[model samples]
Target chain A: MTTTLALLVDLAAIVLLIAGISMFRAPQRARLGNLVAALALTVAVVLVLRRHNVTGLPLVLTGVAAGTILGWIVAVRVTMIQIPAMIAFQHGAGGVAAFLIAFVELTRSAGALTPVTRFSGILGLAIGAATFSASMVASGKLAAKLRSAPVSLRFHNGWLWLCAAFIVGAGIALLLEPASGAPAYAAGIIIVAAAAGILFSIRVGGADMPVLISFLNATAGLAAAFCGVTLENRLLIAFGAVVAASGSVLTLVMCRAMNRDLLKVFAGFTPAAAPAGAAPEHHEPKSPGVPPEDPFLAAVDALKEAESVIIVPGYGMALAKAQFKVVELAGLLERQGKQVRFAIHPVAGRMPGHMHVLLAEADLDYEQIFDMADINGDFASTDAVLVVGACDVVNPAAMTVEGCPISGMPILLAHEAKRVIVCNLDSRPGYSGVENPLYESEKAVLLWGDASDSVSQLVTRVGGEA
Target chain B: MLDLAIMLAVLVCSFIIGYLLISRVPPLLHTPLMSMTNAVSAVTVIGALLLFAVETTGLEKALGVFALITATFNLVGGFTITDRMLRLFRSDEHHQ
Candidate 1:
C-alpha cells in the first residue's frame, strides 16, 4: 500500500476511536453506534492496509478482532458501572501496541543508531514500557481483578531520588556511547522508573485511582507516540497524540473531582491521613425535625400534585441498577398525568453518564434526561427528589463541610427539593469516603432499601394506588 | 527513536486530557469511567511483554521490561481498589 493511503487509514482509525470515547457519555444506543463506528473504521483501515500489502502478525490481527467483538458485547450487555474496566482495558491495549511497535523498530535496527536517535529511542522505550506496565497494573486494580493497597516502603522518597539519579547517570553514559552499550544503561533507567511508579501508586489511597490511572494512560499513549517519532511514522504519531490528549483530559477531570493538583498527586505523595482521633466518629444521621418521607409515598404525592417532576440520580442510583425501576416508576407517574424528567449530574454514576446508561437500560427516551445545570433551577418548583444510592455527590456536605474529604467538590443539590426521598439502605460516605450531611438535613428522608427493589416496589405501590 | 519520543509525549498529553475530562462528570460515572480506562491501560501488559521476546535493541528490551512491571502493578492495584469500592453496592450487608 502507498504510504499516504496507510497513513489515511490509520488516521481514520484514530479519529473513530476518539469519537467513540467522546460519545461514551451519550445514551447507550448512541455510545454503541459510536463504538461500532470506531470498530468499522478500524476494520476499514486494516482492510486498506491489507490491500496495500502492509501485513500484521496473525496474532495481532486475531487479538484485535477478538477484542473488538468482546468490547462490542460488553458495550451492549454491561451496565455503565462496568464501563470503567472496559476503558482501562482499551488503554492497556493502546499502550501495549505502542510499546511493541517501538521494540520491533529498535530490534530491527539495533546495531545502527546515531547518538541522538539512540538517546530518543531509549527514552521513548523506557517511558513507553514503564507506562505500559503501570497501566496494566492500574487496569487490574480498577477492574477488581487485583487488589489495591498502598505500598509504602520506608524512606520511599529517598529511594526514588536515588533511582532517578541512577537513571540520569545511565542516560548520560548511553549518550556517550549511543550505538554500542546504551541500551544496557537504558535498562537500568527503565527498572528504576517502574519501581518508582509502583511505589508512588502504592502510597495513594484507593480513592485516587481514577486520577492515577488516567495519568498512566496518558503516559502509555505518549510512549507510543515517542516510538512513532523514533520510527518517523506520522500515523503512529497522530494516533498517539490523540490517545495522549484524551487521557490527559480524563486525568484533569479526575483531579477536579478530587479537587487536587495533578502535579502534587503524581509526585509520589499522599495527603495526611485523617489525623489519629481526629476523624469524626461515625454516627447515624439524627433525622432532624420531621422524619424524611418514603420515596415511594413522596412519588405518589408528587404524581398527584405536580405537573412536572425531575428525578435526580447519583452514584447511588448506578450501584442499585435502578435505571429500569426508575423508568418503571417514571412511567407509572407519567400515567398519572405528570411529566417526569431525569436530572443527571455530569459525573452522576460511576464512570461518566452512569445514570444515563442505567436509564437507557430501562429503555427510557433519551430526551427525558436533564443535565444538572439545566435542571437545578427546576428542583424548587418540583415536588420531590428521589435520590437512590448516591451519597457524596448529592450530599450538601461538599459545600457545607469545611474540611471534609469532599469539601469544595461540586455536588448535586438533592437537598434543594421540597421533599427529598432517598432510597438508600443506610448512611455511608461516598468515593471520597466521607459521611454525608444531607441525610440529616431538615428536608431529607431515607427510604431505606436496595435502590432497584425500592424503586420497583415504589412503582408497584404507586400503580396500585393509581 | 525520534518517533518514539513523540509518541511518549502524545501518551502523556492524552492522559492529562483524560484526567481533566473526569472532573466534569457526575459522581455516578466516576467508578465505571475509571474502570473502563483501567481496561484500556491493562492492554499494555500484552503489548509490553511481547516486545521482550522481539529481539529489540538493548534499550528496547529494557523499556519492554519496564512496561511489563508498571503494567503489572497498575492492573493489579486498579482491580483491587475497584472491588473494594464495589462493596458499597451491597446495601443489604451494611446499613440497618
Candidate 2:
C-alpha cells in the first residue's frame, strides 16, 4: 500500500472513532457510538494485518482467538458491581501489551534506533509496566481483594521519588550508552517504575478511587502512544492519544465533582484518621413524634404521606446490594401518585457513574434519575427524602462543618427535605470520618439496619397500603 | 524527521479532538466512555504484530505473543463491556 493510502485509511478509522465518541452526547445514541468505535478498531486491526507481510500467522491467530474468547466470556458474565474491577484489570492488560511490545522492539534490535524512537521506547517500557502494577492494586481494591482504605507506608512519597530518580538515571544511561547490557538497563527501569506505580496508587483510597483509576487509564494510554512512536505507526499513535484524552477528561471531572485536589491526592495525602471519641455520639436523629415507638412505622407513615419523593443512594447501598428493593420501593411510591426521582451524587459509588449502572441493572428508568447538580434544588421542596445506605453525600457537614476532609465538598442537600428517612447500617460517619449533622436534624428518621430489608419492608407495607 | 513531525501532529490533533468530544459526554455515560477508550488504546496491538513481521529472537517472539494476547483481550473486553453498560442506559423511547 502507498503511504498516502495508508494515511487515508488510518484517518478514516480515526474519524470513525471520533464519531463514535461524539454520539455519546445522549444515552440513546451512546450504544450506536460504542458499536462505531468498535468498528473503527476492527478496521485499524484488519488494515494492519493486511498491510504487513505477517509471518507466524497461525501463532497470531491462536493469540487473537484466546484473547477474544476470554474477554467476551468475562464481558458477558460479569455483573455491574464487578465493572470497576474488570475495567481496572483491562487497564493492566493494556499496560502489559504496551510494555512488552516496547521491550521487544527496544531489546530485539541492535543500536540502529533513532533517538526519538529510543526515548519513546524507554517511556513505553516504564509507563506500561508501572500502569500494569498500579492497575492491579486499583482492581484489587475495587474488587475487595485488597484493603479498600488507603494503605500508607512510612515515607511513601520519599520512596516514590527514590524510584523516580532511579528510573531517570537508568533512562539517561540507556540513552547515552547504547552499548551491551542495554536490555539490563531497560529491565531495571521497568522494575523501578512498576514499584513507583504501586507506591503512587496505595496512598489513594475511598472516594478518590475513581480519580486514581481513570488516571491509570490515562497512563495506560500514554504508554500505548509511546509504543506507537517506537513502532512509527501513526494510526496507533492517534488511537492511544485519543484514549489518553478521554481518561484525562474523566479524571478531571471526578476530581472536580469531589472538590478535591488532584495533585494533593497524587502526592500521597490520605486524610488523617479522626480523633477518638469526638464523633457523632448524639447524632441519633430526633425523629418527629413517633409516640416513643417504631421508627420503621414512623418512616413508613412519612413515605405514605409525601406527594413528591426523591431517593438518595450512596456506596453503602451498593455494598448491601439493595438496588432491586430500592427500585421496588420507588415503584410503590410512584403507584401512590407520588412523583419519585433518584438524586445521584457524581462521586456516589466506587466509580464514576457507577450508581446509574447499578440502578439501571435494577431496571429503574433512566428518566427517574437526576444528577446532583440537577436535583439538589428539588430536595428542598420534595415532601420526603429516602436515603438508603448513604451517608456523606447526604451529610450536611460537607456544607456546615469546617476544616474536615469533606468540608468543602458539594453534597446532595438531602437534609433540605421536609421529612428525611435514613435506611442505613448506623449513624456512624461516612468514608470522610466527619460527623453527619443530617442525622441530628429534627425532621430526619433513622432506620438503623440493612437497607435491603428496610426497603423490602417499605415495599411490602406500601403494597398493603396500595 | 518529517515522519516524526507527522506522528506528533497526529498525536496532538487526536488529543485535542478527543478532549473536546469526551468532555461533552454526560456523566451518565462516563463509565462506558472510559471502557471504550481503554479498548481503543489497545491499538498498540499494531506494534505487537509488527514484531512478528521481521525475523525475531525467541525472547522477542515470546513477548510478541504476550503483547498480542493481552492487547486483544483489553480491546475486545473493553468494547464489549461498554456495549453492555450502554445498552442498560437506553430509555423506553428506543424500544418504541
- Report per-candidate DockQ: 0.11, 0.82
lDDT of 2 by residue, A1-466 (tens): 4378788888999999999999989888888998999899888888888888889988888888888888899889989989999999999999999999888877766476788899999999999999999999999999999888888888887898899999999988888876777899989988998998898888888667889988988999899999988888888899999999989998998888878889976765445365666555554544443433888777888988899999998888898899999999998889889999999988888888888899988988888889888998778899899998888788787788787888788889888899999898877778777767777777888887888888888888878876
| Model 1: per-residue Cα lDDT over A22-126, one tens digit each | 544533323343334335333533443444332224533444445445444444454445655555555554555554555454545656555555565656666
lDDT of each structure?
0.57, 0.86
Worst 10 residues of 1 chain B by lDDT: B86-95
**Worst 10-residue lDDT window, candidate 1 chain A:** A26-35
Pairs that clash in candidate 2: none
Distance from true location, Cα of A446 in model 2, Å: 0.6
C-alpha TM-score for every candidate: 0.71, 0.96
RMSD versus native structure for model 1? 8.0
